[model samples]
Structures are given as structure tokens and as C-alpha cells.
Target: MAVARHVADTVLFEGYVLYPYRASATKNRLRWQFGVLVPPSWTAVAEEHDFQRTELLMEPRRGATLALETRFLHAGRRTVQRALPDGGFETVPELRLDDRVLVPWDEGHEEQVRLTVAVDELAGPGVVVPFTRPAAETTEPVTDKAGRVVGRLVRRREEISGVLRIVTGELDGPYTTRRLSVVVENTSDWTPAEDAGRDAALSRSLVAAHTLLCLDAGRFLSLTDPPEWAGGEVARCRNLHTWPVPAGEPGTEDLVLSSPIILEDHPSIAPESPGALYDATEIDEILALRTAALTDEEKREARGTDDRAAAVIDLADSLPAEVLERLHGAVRGLREVTTSGTPRTPAPAAGMPDLGPAAPWAGAGGADGAPRPDTPWWDPGADASVDPAHDHVLVGGRPVRAGSRVVLRPRLRHTDAQDLFLDGRRALVEAVLHDVDGGVHIAVTVEDDPGADIRREQGRYLYFQPDEVDVADPGEAS
Candidate 1:
């Protein structure tokens, strides 16, 4: 085995063909992730034009091909980002990406961005990929009243190197979404070592690892259900403000926060890096902050009432169809995993490069939607379509499979003007539908809708029914 020569931003093996990390069944080793993260700036682009995110699952084999999903974020999407100082509505657009017509997130919408690699390495190297710290999920896990890691939310954070790779792809509408396969794989010439040295990549990765483990330890010892990363003097909430969207549209969403958070330095608390703060004490605090900020934005939209609670509820009534599209896959229903669109995963050896898809970070129309009449709280909401013990069933008695495309047609108010308007405009619209007591209970949730019905919750329902509208085949995202 020759002395290994390190690559600047990649993994290298002895002479290109590196040996994979052996399985770890006995003890736990440093968790690792092969995925790459786009920077924070990409959110705006992702939300505005609409893009998709494809999560790649590494097989036991060295590599796999993934496709990108298509998406378009309209007014009501709730995807939010708290890390951005000014809490604002964010998005998780699933851009249609394939082998041809491939595009990068920055191509049309360039802004600050970060792409976090995603993988589940529960067992070991093959079973799980470490990187997960910078995940942009809107919600976070919390502790129980007794101060133990409870089972309300399932959040797994894996750490990886700070420096990430960049992989771009194209997404043309219609028929097939292709992938960009790495035709040329690199070879290394270094000998495998029981211990790897601390190179730049290794250094960044270690920093992330230390931060996460410390966060875990801290969260484990949290004293607040709504955790606060730092607590000393009770700071006044008066100055905490929000950042409005670029345009002052009555119902546009906020993509960033313009407020100032006093990062008071505390020698007592050791930070992994400068300004690297993790409020592991509780995830609810962040959620609350996000909600408040979103509320302020909704009020600014003036689409309806001024009450924060009512505003948020009304905002969710007509979520942008683009947001749903991002999470749905065409064939495998795997959230659009195209070769270029999928998250970049680091192959064990140097040269196996993967830059996770950068679609979602393309634009910013982040989701501050127009307000509308909300479904009554009494509504049971959409039924959980997925159960580990059960199999996939057709929604609303409508046959569906991995590749099924279900067009929705909401039940509109019986009116000559409404019929004439729909017929003259001929616009595309869709609402979710699920079977009930025989006929489909088309949910209604529009400003003037009287019979619209649909309930929204996390991880519980998959279908929604928009009332007093129409459903057409998903067309090419404009």
C-alpha cells in the first residue's frame, strides 16, 4: 500500500479503487453521510419557480441512480426555515430533473444556498450515512415533561464535513424525468488505513460531528420543554421582528427574517464554532418562533383577519399545489431521485463524488399564502393513508400506483357565473381526494367555498379535497 495523497474536497482510496468501510456490528463509530447540502440562499429560488428535492437511499452496492421530482410553490405552502435569522416561510420544491433538460438551482435563481447531505446510517457505514446536522426540516423533536427523549417526533441528526460537493441537473416538464449518471469514476492509489488523518475534509467533518454529539448530550439534559439554547437573563420579546418578502403582495410569503438576535457570548457555554448555536433544549421554542413570524407575515398579507392564530389557519387552507408536487414522485414515489437531482453522497473512497440536487434552493416565493375560510376544528381531517402494517390503497376508490397521476376536481358552488368563469378561463387546478362513505368527500377550502372540506396534519394524511374548484392533469410547471 502506498502513502495516501489526500484530495482537497473528496475521498481518496489507494490508487482510485478504495476499499469500503467495513461493517461495524460490535461498537459505534463516528456517524457519516454521503449526501451534499445546498447553501441557505437556494430556498428563495426553490420556492418561487418551484423545484423538487430527491432523497437518495444508498443500496448495499457502491452507487445508485436517482431521479428529480417536479414542483411549484404557490401561496399556501408552510415550509419554513428558522436558522435564517428572520424566520420566514420556506419551501421544499421538488424540481423535475432527469438526464436531459437538467438545470442547477443557481441557473435561474441565484442566492445564498447550502445543501445538507441526507442519509440514514442507523446500523453502521452501509446501514446509515452520517451527515444530517443542517437538515432544513420545519419542525424539531422535543423532550417530555419528565425530561427524557420521548416518541412524539422522530429526528435523527447525522454529521458530515462542512465542505460539500456541487452536482447540478435539468428538469423539463412532461413524461419522463431523467438522471445524470457519473460515466467516469475516479481511481485512487493510497493504502487503506485503520485510522484516517485530519485533512480539511476530515477537519470540517469532525467539527460537525463534535457539534452534533454535544447537541445530543445537551438535549438529553434539557430542562425546558420549549428548549432555549442559551438562558440567563429573560430577554424582552419586544425587539424581535420579522423580514417581509421582497414584494408586498397581499398574500406573498416571507423567505428570510430581518430581525436581530443578540448572540450574547457566554464563556460558560462552549460553542463548537463561532455563532454555531444549537437550541437542543427544546424544539418547540423554535417552532413557536417560526409560527409567530409566519403569523406576522400573514397579517401583512391582509388576506383575511388580523388574529395570528386565525391567520395561520386560514393560510393553510389553500396550500400551493407546487409544494405537494415536490414531495410526490412519479414512478417509484421516492420524492424525485434523479442522478443530478438526488442528494450527493460521498462514496467511501476519494473520487466517488455526489453533489445532492440543488433544485429547491432555486427561488423564493416562500409560503405566505392568501387567507381563506378554514375547515372547522371539528373536522377529523384526512385519514392516515400509510400504516406500516397495511398496504397502499386507492384514494377515493381511484386506482393509483407508484406511477399513478390522480387529477382532482373540487365541487364548486352551483352558479352560472362560476360555471362560465371556469369554462372561459380553463385554468388548471387540483385538490386532494380520498374515499369516504361511497362517494368521494371533496374537501372545500376557498374564500367563497361553502362545502369545501379538508384537514391538514403532520404524518397523518396524504390526500386533500379542494372545494368549489376543478382538477386537471398536472401540467408542465410554468
Candidate 2:
């Protein structure tokens, strides 16, 4: 089960939420391929003639060689005359975004736009222009007007399109340098295809070059890999995510580069490393609505076309029956944890492998393969603490020791914790534990509650990552 949870994490690792999750995000509408070198004309800009410069963070190790593979698309453009209301003649560049680049331009000035793509490699104060096309014979030192040698112009040719490879010697390791750019410059005077013709004129121009930076396997495995003990689990988690690399030729080893790292802005990970990508509490609440029991009027509200409720209802219906049943059982267990009641652990469904050994902390069964009588799931006796002597753990960037006041910071999703452990409300950090997967978690007992024998009930402690808590100074912990 723990392994299964890691597998789920792997699947949700990349492309889970796109750059802009909502349709309202207009600024991030276009999906730009990472590190792609494309003609300036293909991009949308208020000003004319600008190249799309892609910058990526490079983590190159010391004493290791590197190989960079770049793939680009070929786009055909034509100069067309558009009549303006002011009677001025304007030559508009039209790009074929689709496969119809062979059709004659509207004004018959059709020509395959010849382009020169160049890659500049930089580290520390040094620069190397290792690749360019069409090849350059007479080369001169080129720098941005700022007098920086930046990178060499590898090649400049009239007709060149496809994958380019640049291999380099061992790079100086143990370094972090942002040359600010590993520039891929397309120096051509072609205009981007108009948006109106984009759907039909999809050509090489529409696709951007995908650059891959790979290191020698031997060197990379030894120096940069995570600790050996955790390597198999990490690989298991990553193996869940299988992104397809774009292939240039059928048998070619070089493929389009893709990354699991979320390069864009996103919320920080919860300190606890909640195994699932979603809020289980919210899912439980939605499940509690019971779509099968809704009245016609309530059904209309559940299926309302305008908002998120309809989507939630749809998702609930689409989910497997076994999943909903498991969720129901989970929520019931949670209810038992918050209350001063003894909740008997449920038996494993028929044919399902026992998860008790994989997740010793779950404490569902004892060594004899029988339910542990009267044992709280959150009890420390289930698994030995990695650091029990330390009375406090770091929470919200502050050291919050046990017995100190803390506040809940549950996620924005609809959750039962929001009501029980309201944000900004003070709570008590009773205990802290580090799980088998090396994640730190703290058990919090709410300061104010309506329950029987809260202190005596071992199940009353709620666990969360340190990030979800803050120090509740003096009076805050009433």
C-alpha cells in the first residue's frame, strides 16, 4: 500500500495541472515548449520582430560530460497584402500552422523561409558556440551590445532544419551559474503566421525545438543521484510518470526532452508530503452528498451547469464503486479518531494483499494477523519515532515544540478539518513522528473542542506537516 501510494504520486508527478488550470488565465494561454528555439515571428507580441528566447535552469555536475540535443520544426511563410482602412499597403506575413504549407500564398509570393538557428553554451565566465547552421566559415567574436562574449554563433545557413547535437567536455562541477540564458536564436526576417490561418497552416513553425541535456550515465549515477538507500523508492515514485520523448527518426537515440520538475510557479509542498495530490477530506464531503439520494431539485443543484458542484457530482458518479466505499470507510475512521470512541479497524477486502506490514504505522493488525484491540491508529507505539527526544519540530519555519501552541492551516479545499481545526485557531502540538518514507509529521490536538475526555483519548491527536502550522503566541492558544 505504501508502494502503491508512491506509484500514485508518480502518476500525478507531471502534467497533472497545466500551467494555467483555469480558462480565465489569459496571460499564460500559449503552451511554449521548454528550451525551444523558435522564430520571433511565431510568438504573439505587441511590438514587431522578436525572437522567442527560452531559458531553463541547468543542474550540471562537476567532472561530468554533457550532451545537448535540439529539435526544431520547419515552417513556410508568405508575404500577403492586406488593405488597411487608412489605405496604406501593409505586407502581412502568413504562417501555415498546419500541413498545408505547400499551397500557393494568397498573393503568390510563396517561399520556404530559410532560417539560421544557433545555440550558445555558457558556464561561469566562459562561453562556447558549439552549434550553428548553415555552417559558418568566417567567424567573428559576437556579443550582446553589452560587450559580453555570451556564446559563439555555431552555424548560419540558408537551408537547415532538424535535430542538432552539441557534446562538451567535463564541466566544472559543484556550481550553480545562470548565464541567464543558453540562448537559441533564430535570426530570420520571417513574420509569424496570422492567428486566422493558424488552424490550417500547422507546420514546423508551430512546433518548437525541444532541447535535451543529458550527462554521462556513469558520472551522473555516482555524483548526483539521491542516497542509495532511498534510490529504489525514488525511482519507483518517478517510474509512475512516463512522459513520451519526441522521436526525430525511428531508430534515433535522441528524443524530445521532457521534465517532471514543475518549472512554473506553484504552491509549495505541504510539509507532511501528503502522499495524494488531492485533499481526501474534501472528496469525503462530496461523497457524503450521496448522488443516488438527491431529490430532483437537489439533483438540479448537484448537476448545475455553471459551477464546480456539477463537476464534483460528475466526478463522483464516474469514480469506481470500490473507491467510494474505501473513501466512506476512511472518513468513518477519521470520525472515530476525532471522537473519544474506539473504532475497530476494518478487515482487508477479499483477495487484497495485507497492507499492515508495508505500512507499520497504520497499525491495522498485530503480529498475530489479528486486529489490535483498543489501539488508536495515531498511537506512537505503532512505530518507533525517529527523533523522540526533540520536544519540538519545525512548523511554519518556526521551531514549535510539543506543548507549545500552534494554528491549523488546512488547504483551501472543502475539508472537515476546516470546521474542526479552523485556520488561525490555536491548537496543541502533542507529539511528532517521522514516517517510514522519511516525512516529518506532527500530532495536533485542537485547543477548544466539544468532546468527551479529549486528553485521555489517544485518537484525539490530528497529524499534519509543519507547514500547516504556526506558533500561536501567548493569548492565541486560549
Candidate 3:
């Protein structure tokens, strides 16, 4: 399921992908383009444009031919980059004024420009030759605020098309061995005054779209069911974010797709290889930091000052088998040592209260071994039942009702959107719903969504099992 991959990538990159993963960063606040199918004319009103579609003319046992047709608005702009103190640069539009003009002259005009295309990694080694044709361009004029023409801005106002024909007949197997990405790049750079708008390719963007096409759809792998090497990648992708198509918009079939291919990182050949960062995830200086306080020497030791762990992880294929084994052993030893020394406590299950003995409604067994019949059942709230025998049907170690505050703790194995449920975030209980099996489902409005993005009117909320949340303290929630 390409859709699942989109969803997982949304999760994996959420918060962490953007620099400074804090929620306060406005850049990380919105889901960019996961599961989004933008029409060719995205800048105009949504109703004015029809959904763009790509056709895959595929046949069984034989290779299929696919066409990538990308159409986008190309504006022209003259810009330059200025360096920042943080060692990065920001793009600034180049602005200049003409003093030689004695009379008012209109510089704004429109013209046509040509675009070249480049196709990348479309086929396996020695197979599937791919080519692209130059795009037919057009131009428009840049006008001043007073309606005086300042300069002519060239625009590639039409579709730039490309075709890729897959020859499965030449391959040894029934299908192509690798996934391919079709990148459409606008090679031409157009310059115009600030009032004319930016270049269609560079200003708006040079690379219009990169389409991912899978040959022999039935033989392809599903993003929803990734293999073991890709499991962690898949999980992270799910945790990313996704956007649904507008209600009346054309379906995904009518959109270009570019999804990340979950591939295993290749091993590095040396300790200081370029891909050393790839090893940082599973083993690196971060591992030492995760452990308890350590002196500088200990931290360096934990980081494998020699970079043996990183080399082994990144350059596994290039090293001798025995040498690789030694590096692996060293890493394993460090992991064991660091993890063994770390202190941790078991987290209590959701909805289970730590009720000390002095409570008025303690369980039946009193100080003595005999059962106490007079003990009253704990009353959590209205619209719920708290039977000890059926913990499954209870919420927050007590019953739940409208207006109760609960936390979200969806299980990983149960729901795909479990990642969407912000763990430990308090939500107001909207209702205690029951299913045919008499199972309890608590409807909750996330505290962050005071406007109620998911509300009772839609029969929607972050519904969860009783064990998924604990009761919030009244004073604290208030």
C-alpha cells in the first residue's frame, strides 16, 4: 500500500525530521504533503482545476510503458543568496532601479523559454534506457504597482511531458528488480525584476515532481507490509503524518506519487566514511549520552573512540569477516555494559490506580484474610461500570462519563493511527460509547484541539480502550 508508506513516513519524520524538533517551531507544526495529491494548477482556486492523472499501460509477464506528464505554473524571478551568521544562507530577490530612463517605460513583458529534462535511476544496471524531451516554454510580463510594465518574465506555462517504457522481456526475471523514480527538472534559469514574479522553475521550484512508478503491480511489495529490514523504517513512516484528499476532489489515482523507498544503508569502507551518520541511529555517541553520567574518558570509550562500531555498521561489506566480527563484539559489549548500568522503573498500566489501604472503598479483602461484604464498589463517575472482574470494560480504574478527563495511550499493535494519539496528552471525555460486545469506548477531544477537530457531531473523536488512558487529576487538568 503506497498509502501506508506515506502514512508511516509521516510518523517517522514527525517532529524529529525537522531541525529543532520542538512543537513551537512553526515549520514543524503542519503536515506538509503526506498522502497529498496536488493538481497541476494548485495555485488557482481548487474548483478551477481538474485532477492530474498518469497512466501505466502494464501487461502480465510483459513489461509496461508509463508516461510522466507534469504541468505546473512557472514564474520568473531574479534572486541571490545572502549568508547568515549561523553558517546558512537565505534567498533574497535581486532588486534594482533604472536611472537612465528619461520617460516612463514599461519593462514588463512575456516570452517563451525552453526546458530540458533529466531522467534518473529509472531502471536497473544495463537495462531500461530512459530519455526526455525539452519542454515548450512561454512568458508573461512583470508590471509595477502603478500598472507600468517593468520587465518581461518568461514562463513555461504549459505541460512538459516525458515517457518511460519498461522492457521486462529483456530482464531475466518476470519483473523489474528495482523501484524507479522519474525526476523532472527545469534546466533553464530565467531572470526578471522583483515585480515580474520568480522564474517558473527556480523561483517556484526547478524540479516539478519526481514520480515513483512500480512495474508489475502484483509482483511489487506493499508499503503496509514491509520486510524485516524495512520494519523500523515502516514504523517510523507510519508515525509521520498524512493528509486526506479534499472530499470532492479526484481520488489518488489521478495524482502523481513520489514516496520514499525504505532501503538498508550500505556499509562504509573506512571509519570516517561519508555514511557514518547512518550508524548513528543504532550505535554512536548518542548511545553514550543515553546512558548515565560519565566522565569524558568514559564517554569517549562508550562512543568507541576508534569509530570501530560505526565502521562495522557502515562498512560491513568492505571489511574482513573476522574484523567485522570483532567490531560487532565490541559494540555488543558496550551496549550490554551501558544498558546494564542504566536505572529504570516499570511504568504502571493505564487506568490502574495505586490505591493504598486507607481508602473507604478498598477491594473486598480487608486487613484480615476474610472478605468484607460491607465494602462499597469504587465509583469513578457516571455512565460507566467498574467491576473488578471485568477490567476490560472499565476506564481509568473507574467508570467514565461525559466531561471526565482522560489521557491517550493507544497500543502500538492495535491501531495504525495509534501514533496520532499523543501519548500522555489529556483530553476531555465526550462520551462513554458501548459496542455490540459490551466493550467500552471513550470518546475524547484532545486538549490541544479546543475547537474540536474531531467532535461528537461526526461520531468521531480519539476513541480508545479503557486501558489506553488514566484519569486526570481534577485540579491539575483545571
All predictions: root-mean-square deviation over Cα? Answer: 29.0, 17.9, 25.5
lDDT of 3 by residue, 16-61 (tens): 2122221223543332222222323333423211122222212222
Arrange candidates by lDDT, highest first: which order? 2, 3, 1
Q: What lDDT score belongs to each candidate, Candidate 1 first?
A: 0.22, 0.37, 0.35
Best by TM-score: 2
Positional deviation of residue 338's Cα in model 1 after best superposition, in angstroms: 42
For candidate 1, the 10 contiguous residues with the lowest summed lDDT are 209-218
lDDT, model 2? 0.37
Better of 1 and 2 by lDDT: 2
Per-residue lDDT tens digits of candidate 2, residues 1-478? 1212222232222221121122122422232333233445544533222222323233344443445433443332223333345654444332121211111121101122222222234333334343333422322332445664422222122333332222222223344322123333444444544553341222323233323334332112211233454344324322111122322222222222332222212112232322232222234534344543545444343332112334444554466666655555332112122122333444342222333443442564654465542444355443343344354677557787667778777664335645554776677777666654456777777777665246527555667777777777776426
Better of 2 and 3 by TM-score: 2
lDDT value, residue 176 of candidate 1: 23
- The predicted structure with the larger lDDT, 1 or 3, is 3
- Candidate 3, position 40, lDDT: 38
